[model samples]
Structures are given as C-alpha cells and as structure tokens.
Target chain A: MVVGLAAGFAPAAVADAYLDMIEAETEKIAGPLPTVVDGEAGAESEEDAGFQEFLAYLKEESLGSYTFFEKLTPAQRSEVFERHKQGASLEQIREIIMERFLKR
Target chain B: MRNCVGMILGLACLMQPVWAEEVKVGEADSEFAVKLTEDTDYLHVVHQGKSVKVQRVQDPNYELRGYFAKTGRKCPPFCLQPMHADPAVTSVGEVEVLEFMENELRDGQGFLIDARTPSWFQKGTIPGSINMPFTVLSKGEDDPEMAAALEQFGAKRRGPVGAMTKTLEGWGLFEAEQKTAAWDFTEAKQLLLWCNGPACGQSPRAVRGLLEVGYPADKLFYYRGGMQIWQLFGLTTVIPDA
Candidate 1:
C-alpha cells in the first residue's frame, strides 16, 4: 500500500525530496551565519557621525565650498576625509577637491 | 532735367555694392588681418547671461599653450577617432560649426554639446557649448539622470505600453524611426557634439549612447576636431563658472 502511494506521487515528491536534500547539504557545508554585535553597530554609527561632523566643518568654514564638495565622488570624499585626518588645511583640502572635481 | 539726372544718379549709387567699404575678414591689407572666413569676422553668442564675442586671436604672434597644445597622449584611451561618428551622422569642420552657431544654435533649433566631463568643462570650453558628459549619457536610458537628460534634449517618455501598442510597434505599422519602446524623439533638438579632439572618444561614446536610446542619426553632428584643433587654430574658449 505504501509503495503504491509513493508511486502515485512520484514526480513532484522526488523533485521536492531532491530540493530538500540539496538544502540540507548546503546548510551542512555552510554553518550558521555570524551575528552582528552591538559594538560593530556602534562603530558604524560613529563613522556616520564623524562624516556628518566633517560635512558640518566644511559647511561652516567655507562659504561656497560645500557646494563643490557635494559634487565629489565617494572615493574623492574618502580622500578628503583622509586628508582632513592628516591635518591638511581647509584651503589645501578645497584645492584637492577642486582638482579631483575638474579631472573627473 | 537736373532733377531727373539726380534721381538716376541716386539709383545708380543705391545699386552699387554697399559692402565695398565694409572691411571683410582675411582681406589682403588690414591691421587685424586674422579672420575666420572671407565674410565672418566674429560670432556673437550669449554665455552665462553675457554676450560673448567669439573670434580668432588677432595677435599674429599668439600661440596655444597648456594642456590642449600637448601632441601625444596614451593611445588606449586617447586613440584617434574616425571622421564620422556614425554613417548617418554628418562630420563637420569649423566653418560648418560657425554656420551652425549662426543659424541653428542662434535660432534655438540646435544645441552644441561639450561631451567631456565637467572638470574639463570648468577649465575651458568652446563658445556656445553646454557640457553634457559622456559618462552621464552612457548610464543607459533607464537611469533617472539619463532619462532627465533625454527629456532635456526633447525626448518624451511613452506611457505604459498596452498589448495593441506593442503589437503595432512590433509590426511595421507604427512610425519607428523617431520612436523607441520607451521614448518619442520627434521633437528632439539637433545636437552637435565635440570633445577633446579627434583622439578623444568622449563625443563618440556620447553619440553611441544617444543612438542606443534611439536618437535620430540625421539630427546628430560630430565635430571631430574638438578643443585641441580649435585651440590649434587660435579659436576662442571660455572658462565656465563653478
């Protein structure tokens, strides 16, 4: 009776069975995903905060510089941040931004 | 009898060449001898709310310097482009460009596009050209910025496609030359595009991009001798404000 019932549902049952087996195998090979920690989340937020602070500095120090700064690509913005970290003056940073803006 | 004679003399004077006293450009003996053509001394075009006079540098000793004057650049990126961007598009020279400025551009029937990036544009560009970067155009029609640019060029987006419209478009029934699946370009402006020089690929890329988006080839013009040749000939360039 059981074999007859299995034969009756053969195609779909076999496909589902194969899919389940593949999923099980994949899960076995790939262990549980790593969990995100509060510290990592906090660090990401801190980075955002730092970028905001840099933007605020740009907006405050220079009158029309922020308009040009907004046009910089992500890589350029990163370079600007790096330069700022190295204690480059606002004029130096603006020049670097303008040069990049002009080139790209 | 005297009145009749005077009238005949006045008519003869009126019929005589009015341009006889007018100093033509490139004439044999003139202090400022440099000229664009036999007739054209200069061009007037409004740039950034100011009327700019576009003319060749009158100083006989003036020479081009700086980036455009450089002879060689790496070939992979700066490989010399062909005269025609596409078979259907017309390749034009300085005279044609000047004519275009006087006719189509002046009449608002066309646009002269500087296809280089904004950075290059900021340094300097040909008079009466607006910068439209190849990067922006090459982003594909579906991109919002690209779509906006297409709209600016007078391409209109079609509404949602129905089955009947698709079927007609698929068949030969619909007018397809100026129509794409997504856009209608019947009202698009005639565009003359230029870049750094014949060695530059920016304008060609822009042309290709527009073609891909179903811009009419007949409406496109390629100025192969771009800023480099323009400068080599001592033509005018204007630095755009940031």
Candidate 2:
C-alpha cells in the first residue's frame, strides 16, 4: 500500500533516500535504534522529553520521508511509535507506517 | 498414662499438615477484619469508614465458561499478546489489579476497565470494573466512539479533545491528530484495563488503539489475565444491574 504512495510522488529510489534521511536524522536525536525493538524507543520516551523532540521532527520535518505520518490517524501514528517501541527500525517504521496508512 | 499421652501428641503432630489454618495477610478496614494481602505482603483498600479487602474469592466451586472459555481465536485480529503492550506498559496480574483498585479506584484517581462489550459486561464483571468494548477503539475508519472514549479516559486532545487535523498528504483525519497532537499527561488518569483473557483481543486491541492515539503506555496497565484468569483464581464477580 505504501509502495503505491511511494509511486505517487517520488519513485522507489527517491522514497529510499527519504527513508534514509528520516533514519539518519532520527539517529541524531536518539542514536542508532534497533529495527525490532523500536517500540522500546516509544516505551522509554514516555517520561523523557527527548521522545517529544524526535516526534516533532516527524511532524515538522520537510522531507517526503515520514510525511506519510500526516496521513495517519493518531492511532495509526501510535502504531508506528509502538513498533519503534517494540524494536522496529526507522526503515521498518516507514514500511510499517506506509502499510498502515496507505493500505487503509 | 505418660506413654498414652505421648501417643496422643504424636497423632496430633501427624494430623497438623492435613488441617492447617488458612493464613491471611493485609488489613481491610470494613465491618469484618479481612486479610486481603499475604501476611508479609500487606495490600488493602480503604472505602468510606472501612478499609475493604481486595482479594481473590476463596470459593472452591467457581468454574469458567463462555467468553473465558473461548480459546479458538484467529491472529492478525485475535493474536496472543506480548506481556508488554508497549515498552512502558506493564502487564499486571490479579494482585496488582487489586492493588490498583485500592489505590486508584478508591481515590477516583484511576479506572478498573472491563474491555468487553455491554452484553458480556451485563452478565458479570470484576467488582470495580467498567465496560468499554475494544470495538469502540477499533470501529470504522472514522471512529467517533474512540475519540470520545479517549477524552473520557482523561486524554485531552492536542487541540480541543476532539479536533481534526490535516495529514501531511492532505487527506484529513476527522479527529486523528498527526502533526500537532499531544496527550496531556498531567490531567490523565491511571487506567487498569482487561478483557476476557490473554487470547481475548478486546482489551489488548483497545490498549493498542489507545497507544496508537498517543495514550502513554505507562499510564495504561494491561491485566493480561483478565476474566479467564480471574475466574481461575476464584475472584469475585458481580452481575451488572444494567
């Protein structure tokens, strides 16, 4: 489903760059995160204000990457956060997020 | 006569293990002095002028059926949940649930939620639990029930409790916040939620939906054992008047 959305704007190659940019920028805020345990990122960040900082980046970041976040409902976005909390990587988050919003 | 006395003492000693007294712990301040917690464990809840005990039922005749007995559910929809719904969320057993009831429910600082439908809830439920079906959180694409439930659970909207926001892609979400949404943690209440059991996706789904809507995992407690385990422990359940 997200692949279809990826096709709408940037080609698969461009979406890859966008995904990479989002990951690199995210790692800058909270170091390199595991793809599977990314849910821990959301899990640990509830009390930490730092998670909010990273979340704001997803909301305001101009890149096409994570822009699909805008299309997602709070519940859907939370699914992305939960995946990260559960150990999903940034790329995995993007894939998961795409699958969530684009498919629906 | 001395040997006869010794023989009687030996017989009494042999019977000790067979008829031991049930040890009770914790203090309940109501009418009766009920020991709710383990002797060293110490768990109790205060209500009105009485410190009521939160405990499992001691009845030996309790049995499980219906929702608690349904074990053949499908995943992707009815999957077995991980102990932690999220990184911060804690999976609670009957003891912690009772503790939460004493601490949060008593003071009105929290909720003991039964994540079952009204029909099931009407049949019977834990002493202090309220009904909230998972479908409320998982209904249609534009779920108004979920939005209201979130607000009722003490989650204030990023804008107004139910305001709409534009997704980056330009598809509008009715009340689903994406960019500017934030859950006000200060005003939020602690929630202890449960459904039929681990296999019952109702509570887990509701919790995940709440998490999806930015409910803090810590403020949310999953009673993974739910009614199935609750019944297994012979906990008290009352039929809702409704």
Candidate 3:
C-alpha cells in the first residue's frame, strides 16, 4: 500500500524532493507552538493549532496519495510525526481530504 | 459572501486526489484515503459508505479497540472520555475488585463470558456468559441463530431494547439467570459480563448497554479481568454442541 501511494503521488525519482518540501514547511510551524488558550489544558491548544495548520497544508497540497512518511517532504513528515506525538486526532487529519471527518 | 465562496473553493481544492491507494486495516469493509505519520500507530480503514479510522499498534494482531483512542475526533464530543476514563482491568486491586469469582457457572460472582464469535459458541462456551463480540454483534432478525436465540429468551419482536434483551437471554446471558437479572437493585447483587478477557471490552460494553437499557448501574459490575481471570483461577468452562 505504501509503495502504491508513493508512486501515485510522486514518481520514485521526484518523491524525495516532494518529501523535502513537506519537511521544511512542517519544521517551520512546529518550532513555535501556538498561543495557549485560556482555561485549556497546558500545551494542548498550541499543539492542536499547529497540527491543524499542517493538516490544512497537506489537504490543499493534494497529499492523499502520499505513501507512509516517504511520500511527505521531510519537513511535512516531521510536522505530522510531531503533531501525532502530541496526540492529534488522526480522524481530523483525514477529514482534510475525505471530507467525512465528523465533528460530533 | 466571498469568504464562504472561498471556503467552499478551499474545501473543493483539498478534495482533489493526488493519488489513490488501497489500505485495509482489520475487518473493515474497504480501504481509506490516508496520509501516514510516524507518531501515529494505526492505518485508516474505509468503506466508501462509511469509514472508521484505526491505529494498527499490533499490526499482525490488530483489533479495533487499539484504534478507539484515535477515532475520538469522529465521535460526538459528548462521547469522548479521557483515554483512561476507567482504570485498566489489570490495575484494579483485589479490594477494588468487589467480586472476582463466579460460583456456579450459573451462579459465579465476578464474570464468566464467552468472547469468541457466536459460530465459536456453537462449538462451546463456559456455562454462563452471553455471546457479545468485541468487533460487532450482528443485529437484526436477519441473523438466524441470533433470531432463534432471542426467541428463546422471550424477546417479543418489540424494539431495540426488547431485541437486545432477547439476544442476551437467548444466549442464556444473565448475571443470575432470567429469574435473577432484574431491575430491582436488591435483586441484581454482584453481576458480571464477560467475553474472553482483559483484551476484550465486549463485557464492559455489554454492561454499559445493560445500564442504558435501564438496568441498575450500582449493582452492575464489570469483570474486566474476564475469561483470563476465570481460566487463571481454574474455574469450570463448558463447550456448546452444534
């Protein structure tokens, strides 16, 4: 499945370049967490917001075909891993494309 | 408004497919569109009709529960609870374990459930426990065995509650046999629901389902340490004949 996704998103030769772009962008936002929301748990606000931004980029960039982390620019992969570590919802991330992410 | 228009356009742009990939996780009906991340532990399982995202922590041994925590965002906000809303079954000490043993397979205390598929039940199950699969309990009269079982339980073709009870009763699943599984809290006493063991949550869900059906909650107990505990203690188990 991973290989299939990689091929569809970026031919093997250019996949590396595509991944590099994602990684760079991911690193930029991850470096600085968003402002903490009042009455919210510590770090969650910033963490969630950062993740949302990264998700938006992935969605707008048409990342549905990307395979594992290899399809992402190194920066993009970093952002995803970073957000996941902070416990972002994978469902919300998927909603960026499938358009079926239920808010309930 | 331009903003609304832009928003719609933005969403449309996002929907454009970069590539299509097939990713199947667990027993889901179909593959889901996914973008994997290193920190995430599961894969998305999607059936175009509906999708349930799962985390594949134990790849070869993955079950839907492991991904429950990941799919919280898709559920109604009210349903989301802290991951550790309830203490781990293993962590609850003996004291906290109000009742941990079953007496007669029929009268046991804690819980003695059969967690396997009902097909497995046709093969056999411990004397007590009602069949409640962790994945999904096949509902509707469409299921012949389930239908026949509920019929035996005196399940009149009423509604959801009646059908659910019939299913349980048909399987002979009651904390203390129908004569005892009553609403009168005093009658409930210490009852447990089980299907398999610590790894299975069917019993817990069954207990919760019962509570929703208006069963007394306090008297209700969850033998989280299910079949595992039963087997460890060297209790009796029965196999059903086809």
Candidate 4:
C-alpha cells in the first residue's frame, strides 16, 4: 500500500516541480502573477484611455484632490475601464466614477 | 630619540580632523546626505554565509529603453502613490536607502526589499536589495506559498487565524522561559520596501499586504523614490548573476 501511494504521488510531485521551474523562468522575464486576488477588486481594471485621461486631469487639480481610483474595488475599476473603452467621454466617466465611488 | 618620536606622533594625532568626510547626494538642497565608512568600490554583505558583493557596475551593456523609459502611463492602474504609502509609514529617498544599503543591510539588521516582479528585478535593481515580489505575500490568506514564506521569515502563528496573534521569532532571550511561547515582535527584522518609484504601486501594495498580515507599521519603510528616481540620479544598480 505504501509503495503504491508513493508511486501515485510521484507524478504529481514531479508535475508540481516542473510547474515551479517554468513559472520561475517565465516570471524572471515577464512579471509577477496578475491576480485580481493580489489585493482587492479595482486592481485588475483594464486600461481605459478616457478614464485614465480623466484621472490624469484630476491629479493636476491642485487643491485637495481625492484618490478617486482607489475608491472602487478592482472589479468596479475594470468596469469603468470597459465603459471608457466603449464610447464614454471624460465627463461621463468622471460622473460615473463620482456617482459610484465618491463618498456622499 | 624614541621619546621625541612618540611626542611628535601625539602632536600629529591632535592636529587630525575630528569629523569624517561628508557625503552629498545628487540633488542640491534636499536634506538627506550621509557619510559612509570610508569610500570603497563595493558594499560587502553576507547572506546565509555566502559573501555577496553589492557594487555598482562601472559600465553595463544594457540601456533603459521601452517601458521604463516611457514617462507616463494610464493613471488608474499605473497611478502615482502619495509620498507616504500610509499615514504611519515612512517615506525615504535614495540617500537614506544608500545608507541602509551600506550599513543596516551590511550588518544584517534589515532587508532592503525590491518589490518588483522577477522580470524587472532581473533587468536591474539597487545594490544590496533582494527581490520579494509583492504578489507572493499578497496571496490569499490560506495560500500555502504565503504560509511557507511567513514561516521562513521566522514568524510563528499563535491562537486562531482571524483572531490570531503572531510574533517575530529570534534566538533565545535573556530568560529561558521567554524563548518559545509567542511570536516576538521585538526581534522582527526591519524591512525597506521599494518598487518602480512614485509612479509604481507595486511596493505600496506589498506594504499594504504586510500591514494586513499584522507586520508592525514602524518596522515597514517605503523607499518612495524607487528605480525611476534611482536611475534619475544615476545611482548604482547591480545585475544578479543567473
């Protein structure tokens, strides 16, 4: 029974080792794992150029500017990125970010 | 003749300057410059018994092009973090970081962490820093990899999970009984974390993850001006051997 179990587990262990090695090499060139679970929701948002432009504008707004981006979770932020990519203007995206994310 | 020679040596010693040479960083009036333990070509450090030379490469074959060269990025994901990661966290500059590299890291009192992914780390990184990608520790609470890492960091768990308490472990204390029971925060090693500078959030994310895992705020330091700023001033970076 012991020998049978050991033999059965060998393949899985070997598979895991290979996976580890492959991942190590890939990461050495590519980047870290892009997991939504790296943090909370909004971290995985897509690069919506319009929404991003609005954020850049906000950052330039000198007096007491808020960190509106971090207000939403990664998933919500992804939705915003998606919306901007569709057809929304900077104004419309700003309105949406404020409505959903900004504290009342 | 011997007595006269001794008197002459004593006079020479008295005339010598009391203060060591002052070190000034690149920027003109920004505060934090430091004096080092005499000028040398390399920063020598011992990690796990192997001596590692942390020195600036006189000339590297590569150049900073493409992504790192690009000045701007879409804001939401590639946003600029505040000078401070959190209210309590400390934000430091290259000068302070260099001092840490020369002193604290050399003595093994602290870890100057490069929170970038292996890709970025492999390209080039500050001398005396070790790569510990932020995502690794940001894994789910029950992640075996995270647990393994935390354990290797000398942190032992106590009590329950959510409502649990953990302490930083070290060698035996003054009391024999005090040696084992709980996680010892006092013995926890200092961590200096950084990423691609102010524009990058990777290091901040790692800071947050560490805080969430109950690492002491005081023990965590953010080198806000990371690689971009490091390269801006043309500070040294060492490429690790594959």
Instruction: Report per-candidate DockQ.
Output: 0.01, 0.01, 0.01, 0.01
**Model 1 alpha-carbon drift over 4 Å, by segment:** A1-104, B1-25, B28-32, B161-175
Pick the lDDT winner: 1
Name the regions of candidate 3 deviating beyond 4 angstroms: A1-104, B1-116, B120-124, B132-191
TM-score of 4: 0.49
Candidate 4 stretches with Cα past 4 Å from truth are A1-104, B1-42, B45-67, B159-184
Q: Please give the lDDT score for candidate 2.
A: 0.58
True contacts kept of each: 0.00, 0.00, 0.00, 0.00
Model 4 chain A TM-score equals: 0.38
Q: What is candidate 2's lDDT per residue for A1-104, written digit by digit as tens?
A: 89877678665565356334423322232221111112222222234444565577566553454677767655445445554544556677678666656544
Model 1 per-residue lDDT at B183: 93
Predictions ranked by lDDT, top down?
A: 1, 4, 2, 3
Instruction: Look at candidate 1 and tell me the lDDT of residue A77.
Output: 66
CAPRI-wise, candidate 1 is incorrect
Tens-digit lDDT string for candidate 1 (B201-228): 7898889889988889988999999988
Clashing pairs in 1: A102-B119
Model 3 backbone overlap count: 23
What TM-score would candidate 3 get against the native?
0.27
List the candidates ranked by TM-score, beginning with the highest.
1, 2, 4, 3
